[model samples]
Target: MELYNWMVEPFQTGFQIRALLGGLLAAVMSSFVGVWLVLRGMSFFGDAFVHGVVPGIAAAVLFEFSPFLGAALAALVMVSLLELIHRTTSLKEDSAIGLLFVGMMALGVVLISRSDSFQGSLTAILFGDALGVSWADVQMQLLFVIGVGLMSLMLYRPLMSLSFSPDKSQALGMRPQLTHWLLLLMIAAAVIGSFQAVGTLLVLGLLIGPAAAAALITRTVPRMILTSLILGMISVTVGLIFSYHLGTAAGASMALVAILGFFLILTIRETVAAIVRRKRSTTLVEQGAS
Candidate 1:
């Protein structure tokens, strides 16, 4: 009876409800925008954006504000900074990204390391402690997810046009740059929402691997997105299960599982392609010899 009670304890905890909901939201949001990130060659941008919020998070902690607000402010600042760099500096996007990310990350580290309340929670914020999730956290996650979904739905035509070709999208009267900005903003929101549950470091895998894996398996953007959502959900669910059994952070475990899914896609695709090529090559050789 004691063992049964102990085994069921984690599930009964209020934190578990928060964690489940939060993880689900992160998975959904990450999967939604991830397809665009992969298509735009901006996978790293997701990582950069997430890491870029560290300083703001630290500041929020320092001032006793909600981490979400701080992270959002940091994201907006980074977006504006990138725009400024593009317009004013000769440094390209990659150079600007590198400079800004490192600088912000360093500042965040300093602030977090100095703040007592945020010290231990740093790990919770970074790698995620699903077991530590609160009602507020879960609610915040749901709002972001809903907001992003609405934006995507409302601007589907413009976003689709913008993604494939900026010039064409513009020709069609869609403001590609505006949509681009909006998309990045949504990505930032997703990152902030995810940061507390999954952390900055591991969120990249959630945003990248699932989408990339889906790409390998599917040809159309919608199909890719569907696959990504399914895969991301799988990762989260399996990760939660693993975390429960292994006593590890669900976020880290989920990220790892998603990465493994990426590799799994690659292996299957490569093996199938190799076999088809071999068969074709052998048939051609036999015909030639005959």
Candidate 2:
């Protein structure tokens, strides 16, 4: 009973309940987005999107506006620029990402430095404040999940085709170009939806870690997404509980746990593969000797 109370006591509070809900919602939404990011090899694009939103959030803080709105706008602008540069210029994808990432992050720093009002919330913007999440924030995250989920379902076929073979998708009349833009929109929504829970800086861990872990264990896309969601939820729940008991930063704890899950899965998978390979090699040598 003492142990149960120790584990359950923090969630009894209103703020902690809100934090749990917010984190869970963010986790589910991010896992779905992370699956696509991992499949499409767009992890760098996700990272760029995460940093691109920083300037918008900084501006929002300075003006006392909605951070989500600012983040969405910034993400849209960055994605558009990336698309334009990649399509129109001779620069490669990596160059475009590097150029935009540094520029946006530097702009955010400049904007924040110029503002005195943003000092109080600067840490929260960079590192997140899960405990500070409010009911309104949870509501917004719910809307984001619903909207993004519906869009993903509608565009599932085209997105899948684009992920595996853009040329083939184009041949199938799926218009890979349009699907690509829609994917960018979905990524932007996911990043903004999760930003308040995990912050822009550590958001990549939440976005990529669980999906990477799930991919190693699951064979199909749906299974991978489901597994990723489970991993993400567990990470948030355990991280929050540990943070409450240990008096640590909740957001950082969650991000760390998610990353730890990826590494744990990787280690287990590699070990199993090594054992299987050794067995096969032994069998082959015995047959040759026979």
User: Best candidate per TM-score, number?
Assistant: 2
What's the lDDT for residue 285 in model 1? 100
Q: Write the per-residue lDDT of candidate 2 for residues 1-290, one digit (tens) a residue.
A: 99888878879989999988988888888887888899999999888889999999998988879998899888878987988998899999989999999999988888888787566567888888899898999999999999888887888789889988999999999999999888888888888888788888877887899998999999988898889989999999888999999998888999899999999999999999999999999999999999
Each model's total of backbone clashes: 1, 0
lDDT of 1 by residue, 176-267 (tens): 88889889987987788787778877888889989999999897887888899899888876777678889887889889988999999899
What pairs collide in candidate 1? 126-199
Per-candidate TM equals 0.91, 0.94
Residue pairs whose backbone atoms clash in candidate 2? none
Model 1, residue 86: C-alpha shift (Å): 0.9
For candidate 2, give the lDDT.
0.88
lDDT, each prediction: 0.83, 0.88
